[model samples]
Structure formats: structure tokens, C-alpha cells
Target: MNHLKALLIKFVMIAVVLIVVLTLIFDVPFMDSIWTSLVLTVLAYILGDFLLFRLAANRSSQNVRNMIATGGDIIIAFLTIWYMQVALVDANGSIALGSFIAAVIIGAGEWFFHKYLDGNVVSKNTRTTADLEADYKK
Candidate 1:
């Protein structure tokens, strides 16, 4: 239930960004933007948030964790959007450039999102008191 709520929040965040950037700016179709958002959201949450962020948080500072996860999310977004552009979206621009731009934007957003996850979404058992103290100190 907690994970589901988190996923929904993340989906909304990514979907809004993708819809605006991919559709409004890059002229991708609305449905394609939604599809890309759906794919990107799941992939990012699994690879970036669930795996990378959790592992990094256990070993690194919050800033470092955010950087690692954000970078992972950027790569995920780039590859997903790039492939979707070719196979799904019929946009009329350089797919690589558009994907890169959208990925960068998503990465920026993910940094803040990670903070939210740590506070509200991630299980407390996964975050030690020392971890919280360390994050608070910095």
C-alpha cells in the first residue's frame, strides 16, 4: 500500500513533466507522452529509486545518494524516451536531443523527489538512526 502510493505520486510527477516536455515542447503526441511516462515511471522507480537509491543511501551521504539515483533516472529516462520516440512517438525532431533534454529535466526533479521518498515513502527500517543523523547534519 505504501509502495503503491509512492508509485502513484511518482507516476504523476513524471507524467506531468513528460507531457509538458515531450508533448508541449517536442510536439510528441499526448498518448505517446503518457505511454512514455508510464514506462519511464516504472523503470525509474525500480532501478533508480528502489535499487540504486536504497543501496546508495546505506553507504553514502544524502547528496551522494541523490546524485547516484538522479543519474540513474536520467539514463533510464533517456533510453526509454529515445526508444519510444522511434517506436511510438512520431515527433519531428532529433530524438536524441529531445530525449536528453527531457532526461535532464527528470533528473533535476528526481533529486527533490528522493528527499520526499526518504521522509515519507521509504520504510523506516531501511533507514538507520545514524543515517538520519548524518543526513540531518548535512
Candidate 2:
């Protein structure tokens, strides 16, 4: 349930951001941009959010873990945008600018999304009542 909620939120966030950025800023076709956003959102949720967050769980600090996950998210978003531009957009133009812009915008939203996941989903197991009490003392 938690995973599904996170995935849905992620999909909606990515779709909105990418649709606006790709269509308005990059001049990508609206339908193509929507398709690209959907594909990228799913891939990013799997690779960036799910897998990277799992990997970051081993880290001691929640802040550090979130940072690592955000980094991975940016990379995944960038690659996905670039690939979509190449394959779907079919433009001879360089994708660097569009990819970078989209990645940065998506990455900003991802940081907050990751924070929500950390609080609501990922940190639940690690944050026992005893742990909360201990932190309160400090």
C-alpha cells in the first residue's frame, strides 16, 4: 500500500513537471511528452525511488540517505529524458539542455518526495517508540 501510494504520487508529480517542461520549454510534442513522462516516471520510481532508497537504508543518517537517493533520482531522470528525446522526439538537436533542465526540475520535486517517503514509509521500521524517545532526549 505504501509503495503504491508513493508510486502514484511520483507518477503524478513527474508527469506534470515533465509535461510542462518538455512541451513548453523544449517544444516536444504534447502526446509524445506525456508518453515519455509516463515511462520515465515508472522507471524512475523503480530504479531511483525504490532501489536507491533501499540501498540508502544502510546509511546511518536519514539526511545522507535522502541526499544519495536524490542524486540517483537526478541521474535516472536525466538519462530517461535524454533517451526519450533521442528515441521518441527523433530530433537531430542536442538533448543536453532539455535533459538537464528537466532533470533539475524533477530532482527538486524528488527531494521533497523522498523526504515524504522517509517520514511516512521508509523510516517506519527504523523509528521504533524507543528510538523516538531516545531522539527526544537529545
Choose the strongest candidate by TM-score.
1
Q: lDDT tens string, model 1, 43-119? A: 99999998889877554477888888899899999999899888995545676788998899888989998988888
lDDT of 1 at 9: 86
TM-score of 1: 0.84
- Structure candidate 1, residue pairs in collision: none
Alpha-carbon TM-score of each model against the true structure: 0.84, 0.83
Q: Residue by residue across 1-100, what tens digits does model 2's lDDT show?
A: 8888888898888888877888887788888778878888899888887777656644346677678888998999988888888888776565667788
lDDT of 2 at 122: 70
What count of clashes does model 1 give? 0
